[model samples]
Structures are given as C-alpha cells and as structure tokens.
Target chain A: MSAMGDSGYRSLVDPEGGIVDRSIFVDDQIFNDEQEAVFTRAWLFVAHETQIPNPGDFFVSRMGTESVIVSRDRESKIHVFLNSCRHRGMKVCRYDEGNTTSFTCPYHAWQYGSDGRLLGVPQNLTLYPDLDKSQWPLVEVPQMENYKGSIWATWDADAPPFLDYLGDAKLHLDLTLDGRDGSEGGSEIIAGVHKWIIPCNWKFPAENFLGDTYHNISHESVDLIGIGPSAAAGQKGRRDADIAEYQHVWAAFEGGHGVHSALRPAELGYQPTFRDHPAVEEYYRKCFESREKRLGDAARLVPFVGTLFPNTSYHGGQPRALCVWHPHGPTSTEVWRFFLVDADAPDEVKELLRKYYMRYSGPAGMTEQDDMENWNYATAGSMGPVARRHPFNYQQSMHASSWEGPVAGQVSTQISEQNPRRYYEAWAAYMDGQSWDQIYSLGQQARGNGR
Target chain B: MNQLPRTSAFFALQAEVADVLSTEAHLLDDRQYNEWLDFLAEDIVYFVPMQRNVEVGTHAERETTREGKDMHWFEDDKWTLTKRVEQILTGVHWAEEPYSRVTHLTTNTQIVTAEPSVDDATIVEARSRFIVYQNRVEYEEYYFVGKRTDTLRRVDTEIGWELVRRDVTLDQNVLLAKNLTVFL
Candidate 1:
C-alpha cells in the first residue's frame, strides 16, 4: 500500500518524520483505525507466565477492546481465548484471575473447559438436542507466544514471529523479563494489577516512556520528596538540565520498539539502598556480577522506562513497573500496571520492592500524579478545534546524535525525539495498511540509512 | 455476623468510638492532614488492599491479610504517612495541588471485639463502611466506597483512642480516579 493512500495516515504522521498532527490524539476515526490496524495486528502483552502457573489457573486480560481468558489447561498448556460465551455472548468468566477447572457463564449454565472447549450446556438435551458442542467453543486468540516469562498474544495470526518482532528490543526487555544469571525462572508479577484510568491519549504514555527524559523536569516534586537522586544532591541544586549528558542511551529497534536508558554509575549498582543490608546486598552483588558477565557494561545501567512498541512498556530501576496503556478511546487510556520482582529475591527484598512500586507508580504514586496532570491537560487541549489544527512538536534533538554505540539499533542521547519519531514512523506504516513484511523492511531501511 | 451483644458498657464504648471516628473523618474531609497525623498511633500500620474478582471456588486465593499479601494500594506506617503529609504540605504534590474536596462518610460502625482495660492501652476492634466523595476540578467528582476494619488503642485516659491499624478493602478492583490522593 502507498503511504499517501486514501486513509490519509500519511498526513496523520509525517512519513518517517518527527512532527505529528494533534488530531491523532482526539479523532474518533483515527482511534478506530488504530484499533483495527495497529492493536489487532501487533503483538500485545497478555500476562506473565507466572500469573497462571498451575493447571486450571487463569486470568482475564484484554487484547485491544476484546477481553480474553489467559489460562493454563489441565494439560498445563497456556491458552488465550475470548471471554465471551458462544451461547449468548455474555462474558463466560468475570473474575480478574482465579484457579478453576472450567468456566460457566452466569447468564446460562453453559460450561467451558480450561482449554476453552465447550464442555456442558444446561439442559442441552432439552434446550437444543442437536447442538454441536465442538462447534461452540470460545474463540481462541490467533497467535500467542511466551518470551522469557512474559506472555503476549496477537489477533492477527500472520503477524511477524514474536521474537523477530521484538528484534534488538529483546536485549533491553531481557534486563527485566530474564534474570541476570539466566536462571530457569525469570521475573514474577506481583499479586495484583495496579490499574487506573487516565484522561489522555494512550500514545502520550507510550511515547513518553519510549524516549522523553525531558519530562524529568516535571518530576521535580518527586525529587523534593527525597525519592529521586536529584534530592540527594541537595544544596548544589539539581543538575537536572545535564541529566541526559550522564551516560544515557536510546535504542530504536525494528517494528517501532524502542528504549531510552540511563546508565547509573557502575559502583552504585542496581538498587543501592539494598546494599545497606548484608544479605540483601550480597544477593544483589551476585546478581549484578552475573548480569555484567552476560550483558557487559549495559547491565550496569537501567532502562528507566521504555516502550515495547505500540502500548506495552517496562520501567526498571527502583520501582520496576510493567505498564500497558490500554486505549479506551482517542481521549482516554486505561493503564494496567504490574510490579515485577525477580522470582528468586529474598522475602524482605520482595516486600521492599512492592512498597517502592506502590509508593512511586500506582494510582496514587507521586511520579505518575505529575505525569497524568500533563497528559490529561494535553488530551483536553487537543479537543479544541484551533489546537487540533496544529501539530505537536517532536523535533527536540532531532538530528543531535546518530547510532554510534554497541547497541543494535539507532542510538541517540536520552532527551531526543528520535524514539518517538521512529515510533510514529512504524505507526504510520501499520495505519497506512502496509503488511508486516513491508513495515519490517521500512524500519530496516530507515535504520540502515540513519534516518 | 458474630457481633458482640449491645450492653451499657458496650453502648458507652461505641459512642466514644463513634465520636473518635467522626473527628477523624472531619479532619480528613477538611484536609487537616498534619492534624490528622496526631490521631495515628506511633507504630500505626494503615493499608488498603487491592480487591480482585476471583472466581467463586477460589476463596483461599482471594482472601488477603495485611501481612500475607504483597499487593496493596496503600501500605503505610506512621513514618510513611508523615512523609505523605509532608509531601502534601509542600504545596507542590500535583495530585493534591488544588486539594481535593472530600467528604468521608462513616456508617454502620460495629464493634467486633473489645479487650479488658490494660495498663498500656485498651484494644478495641471495630468495622465501618466508608464512602469518600472527592471533588477536584469543577467538572470532576469521584466516589470510592470501601469497608474498613480498624484496631484502635486507647492509650491512657488522656489521649483516648489512636488508630494502631486500619485495613481498607475497596469495592472496585480497578480504580476509576486518576489518583487515590485522598485518604479513605
């Protein structure tokens, strides 16, 4: 498909360019198009494997607007199926997560096995004698894959292979998903999902995490609360302006996957405060040692926050939160956040990690409070006719740096628009109705030419 | 359903507990955060667990206690609560910049248990339904309902009751508000 086709997706985002029209955030038509084009076709994160470990364990998750049951069958195989019952379309499973051998619809006593096979229907012999039970199973997700421990599913079966879609972004994703020692078990999602609604476009959070360390200024209040490093620098005043200069890296991967990372001093290590306790500190030291051996110097730094293409993002460091910006509409997003900790961490460390996660990233989190205010206002502002006409600027540090590091893809200083530009470039590809192959080739060409 | 029988002493204790709860609610509703801190015991553990929609057969997995569970919306101690108050008083915490106007409605206050008077503190266990109505901007209003189980300790006759512990279990699994800046 041509970029400048009838969809006008080309006009929505400049082809491989930085600027983006504001209408993309507020237009209903564009939102619907994204649901069909980007969300359905792209690999969307469902749940971590640890969430549904045992047979009959299940959790209800969303793929775009459609709800799906992510479960482990009696055979202990993972399955993702639509939550809707084939009998009448009511949600077969209503719970967030639980362990059950079968799901029975509340409306009618229609039962489905853990593997999503229609098992029983109340009064089947009386109500519908000739009903074909095999033909009435819950609709299954076309493609589902587990990378490391995180589970992802896509509605489009023809989408690129999961790891191939991840590409170089997997290196960054591994820092969180896969443990340092390459242990048999990776990370585990905390007990519950910290979910809340934000009155903003989903792209704002996605793009922000992808590469907008520039927004660090907005978190000055968080620093003042003695939570951020700038707070520790006290009397010298914050060296906020030069944060990007301090060993930061940006990686733009194929398929719009990108990450902006800040390499904390190697001596400081992963979670420095944990070092205060002898046992906890020793555990971290061993982990870091293994990580350094595996990933080299890159292991020393943290991927502060980065998007796994479209909507899923992982924010590591003090309070590691795995976030999914579930788009409700063009104007609003439902953010499903899960705190992740190394499955092998000590109980005390896990407790502290959970506390840190809640304190900094949950619905009442201080850092998120600041960001939501900006995004909420930004979304509301775009509703204005005059505001929608103008394009939001993405030209910051546009040509400042090129790919010149050990990282696999396009590399830039942390405070650059290169990641967002690349993100929208991929968005434009999907929106323009291009095939996955075409999108991959376009990204490769762009990266090759250093665009 | 195993509620303590109402007696003369029980009535008096209930009245006192109701008064203390009313004052606490008033302080929170008025945004008297610093003053509200005084009502908490020195080693208070205030927490709000995240409710989940677990299936019917899985009551064991669904039941969460303060010590057993890793996930909670608010797991705060006196120190953390003080810090939260300090953050709010800085006049810069963006979520509470304009300060949410809140009304904490406490009802159905039931005394679950009461221990005999002791030298250090008198222990009292109570439960109440809480509905917090919060208004931020002119157009935005949010309501959160939960049931609270509080362990109040009357430390000596002078200070009366201080909240040693509180467990708030919200009705909604997914919070609709932008932030849970207000105390429930």
Candidate 2:
C-alpha cells in the first residue's frame, strides 16, 4: 500500500490524513480527465447477459457518458460497439432496445450488422468505388468479458483482464451474482429496466456504495418506519435480523472494489427472514439448509452491498439488483438499475421480491429516496468557493484494520472509512496514469487466494 | 361514425367522475395526505410503468413494462402507499421534509367504459392527462407530464368514489427527476 504514496498522485488524495480534495466532485478538468483515465481504462459494466439473451437482441447502454450498443449477433456472439455510425456522426441505433437485422443509420442509411460489421453503403459501386467495407465496421470495444451473467468492457486493450482486476473482490461479487441455494450464476434480471436522472456527481453514489457503513444514520426516517422483510413481525430496522450476531466485514480490494458482507457463524443457523410470507420463509430456510450442505464453510458469507470499482453497484440480499451510475457531467448522473431474481424462483417469490424492490430501491424507494436527497444537496454544497476549500473528514477508525480479513482484502471490523480511502487512493493512481502493476496493491492477494 | 345522443343521466355521471378527480388533486395540493388515503380502496393497486423506446410494430407489446411482472417507477399496494405517507409524516424524510411546492393538474377527462350500463354504473374506467409541477428547496424544479388510466369505484361514502386501481404512464422514457416522493 506504500507504493500508492510513491506514485506522485497523493496531493488530491491523502490516505494518511484521510481527506480528499473536493475538486474531484465539482472541477471540470478532473471530470474530463476521469473519462479517459478512470472510465475508459477500467472494467466498466456494459450490460447483463439476460438483457440480450436471444440472437439479434440488443440493449443500448452507457460506458461513461458515451452511449454504446450491447448486441447479440445472429450467431449468438455478444459484442459492444459505439453507437455512432462510421460514415456520418449520427447514432446508428436510436431506439432504446430491440432485436434488429442491422443498425441502419437514419441519416445516410449506412447499415451495419448486429455483429458491427459494415453491411451496406448506399450505391457503393457507383458513389464510392474501391471503398473497402472490411475496414469500416462500427468501432467495437477492444476487450469485453462476460463474468457469470455480467458483461464488462474496457476501451484500453492493455488493461488487465476482468478477473485479474476483480482480484479479491470476486468472492464478494460472487455472493451478489450467485443464487440463494448456493448455486453458480442462477440470478436473472427482471423484465424491465428502471432508469432515472440525479443532479449529482457520479462518484457520490459510487463512493456511497463503496462500503460506507457510517451513512446508516442518514436513513433514520426509514429505519424508524421499519420496512424490512420482517418489519411486520416486530423487526424494526432496514434489514432482516438473520445476521444480527454475524461478523460484519467491510472488505476492500487492491483494485478499488469494496463490499460490506456478513459472515454467519454456524451457531446462529436458519433465522427466519420473512414474517409476512410463510412460503417465502420456508423457501429461504430450504435454501440455507442446502447451501450449508453444498458449500460447507464457504456458505457462511452473506452479501449486503458492494461497488465494483468505477460505477457499478449491487444490492445482493433484500433488494437484489445491479446498478450503474453513468456520468452525465460534473454535476449529473443518469442511473440505470436492473433488478435481479433467481430464474427458477417460484412466481410467488418473484412477486414478493418485486414488491420489496419497489419500496427498497429506485427513486420511489423509501430507503434510497432519502439517499438521493443527500446526494443532490451534497453536490450543490461542493460547488461553493468557501465550501470547496475544506475537504471531507474520512478518518473514522483510521488505523483500526487487519491485513487479512476473513472475507478478503483490508478488513475493518467496526464502522470505518478505510474503503473510501482505498477507493480514492486507486482513483488517484488512475488519474496519474499508472499501469496495472503500479495500480494493484497485491499484498492482500495472497490471502484471498488461499481459498 | 355513429353517435349516441348525450342523455341527462350521462351528463350526471360525467360530472360526478370529473368531480372525484378534481377533489383528489386538491387533497394532494393542500398537503392533505392522510385525508387523501380515504379516496383509495383497501385493496387498491397503484402502478406506474416505465415507458420504453421500442420499434414501431412493438408499441402495443413493449412500449410500457408489464404491471405485475416488470420493474417500474412504482408497482405497490395500499400497505406500501401508507408506509410512504407514514415515512413523510415522520418530519425527517429529507426528500419531503421541507415539502416541495407541488400542483397536480388533471385534464382531458373521459369516461372510457362503464360496467352494468352507463345509467346505473357502479364501476367506471376513466382516462385523463396529468401535469405535476414540483419546485423543491430553493432552486430545483421538475415537470412530470403523463397519461393516467384509473379504475374508480362509486362507494357509499362522503367522497362517493375511491381509486380501485391506478395505472399511470409517465411519457418520458427516462425519469428526469431524482426522486418520486410526491404521489401521482
């Protein structure tokens, strides 16, 4: 971790002092630099595989601020390409999502196949002779990887592979993507996408999700109202009491990914989560029993929330979903959330989860609506001259951390700001143009690999 | 097109339905959330679908997300709706603490269908357009314009009608507001 201080990017981010420059949220120059340094080079979440499972299906998504089309070709190969047409600058595909034989540019009718191959040029033989069609395919992302059901892409070809970048973060992310029965990649997104705009910097939501355990106090109204899974059963909090005595871990990886997960002790087994629905409780009880049998000691890890590096975030347990905070400018974010449910889940379970997700997430959500209010006003607060001079205090429980957490990475047992500190440290490295070798702090990797 | 003559009974029903809508909007505008709950049935199903940009041919099938099966801005019931009101009443819900100045405008009112005949209708299918103007704190403002199709039931109460089911179609494909704290 000391190598991060030697990289000459420590001015904006001082981990020792645990204070960060406010310009990263409000400065135009920092925002512009981040487009190339942070978003372009990082493994950005493009789309979920379930969004475009069939051949010829496509879904328009955003990498950073630019639009990209995530398409499954007729041959069933997934590809991500810039939405711009080669001949002219017009967007080749404007409709949000639909299956199509080709993306025909509305401007000049420059047609490109679902595979992003240049298919048609109006009067190619007479208007433009000797024009090589092979040279002009729609510009595709240099690298793309589908980890489990998630699709990630990077513009920089030299960037590390997706799994390598995940490092120790994979175990926590796996908890989010896996099924309740301890199966591999059984989660599938629900039918529609929830999209909204927030007037705030992109990092506000990203850093919030990057294991900000201290922000629970801000949700005082929601916690008082008690809208958890067992809220009707005298459970008065934001989540179920199944993990009351479980060891809560705030884990941060070398590559800037971080998660807040709980390790359930074997002594506290099969706590009922849903008081209103007996079927739901029974379903989960069976899942917990089989999970213990299948994964043995590993099944103890339960997911809460996590953010994967730049802008992708997830809520694994109660309100299961994957979300992306797309950078619109220095002070705006376009958020898209894909709610997830197990593919084999009973219709009743899916229905219950859907209703829970509505009240727990998105703009209408009781819990996250309060969060958006904070983000909106906080971004406005950062733009003032005097307010910008002072940095935010992030020194809570600064030195109280263990090198090898039971989960992975730098582990904090109590409420701590170490995750955000690590997140900003890696963010400064990206801003300073450091390579993968200099970026990843591999001291914790050895412990993560022991499993 | 053939036309049916507008009868005295039809005019009476139309006026009554429009009055119910007008009263509901006023309750919200006055910040009478607790009183507004009386206008909803015990088993009311409130849904606001997320509009999507689809191919021309798929408009009927894919323009809006399915109510019970897909994700949306809102797909909740009376219990959850009551919780929203309760959360706001706590006086600490930052999204609505100061309470944004909101005015809901309902127009283009029409009675599309009537069950048990128009003359003796106890249930009616109504359609209208809404424009909600919200200004928050000091400078934030948002305009939500959309279509609303509601199932209004004629109840034997002082208000005489209650919202049995409400399905709102917010015209924008992507919601332009940060949060949907106000009721639609």
- DockQ of each two-chain model: 0.59, 0.85
lDDT by residue for model 2 (A1-451), tens: 3222444445888777889988788888778888888888999998889989899999999999899999999999999999999987799988888899899999999999999999899999999899999999999999999988889999989988899989888988888889899999888899888889999999999999877878888888888988888888878777688877889898878878888899988677788898878999899999999889989999999998889998999987888889999999999999999989988989999998988888989999999998999999999999989988999888988877777568667888887887888888889878888788878953344235331
The C-alpha TM-scores of every prediction are 0.92, 0.96
Native contacts matched by each model: 0.59, 0.86
In terms of docking quality, model 1 is medium
The RMSD of every model to the true structure, in order and in angstroms, is: 3.4, 3.1
Q: Per-residue lDDT tens digits of candidate 1, residues A322-417?
A: 899998888889889877888888887787667666767767776678788788888888888999778988887766656666466788854688
Clashing pairs in 2: none
* Best candidate (score: lDDT): 2
Q: Which stretches of candidate 2 lie over 4 Å from their true place?
A: A1-9, A442-451, B1-5
lDDT for position B56 in model 2 = 95
Worst lDDT 10-window in candidate 2 chain A = A442-451
Q: What is the TM-score of chain A alone in each candidate?
A: 0.90, 0.95
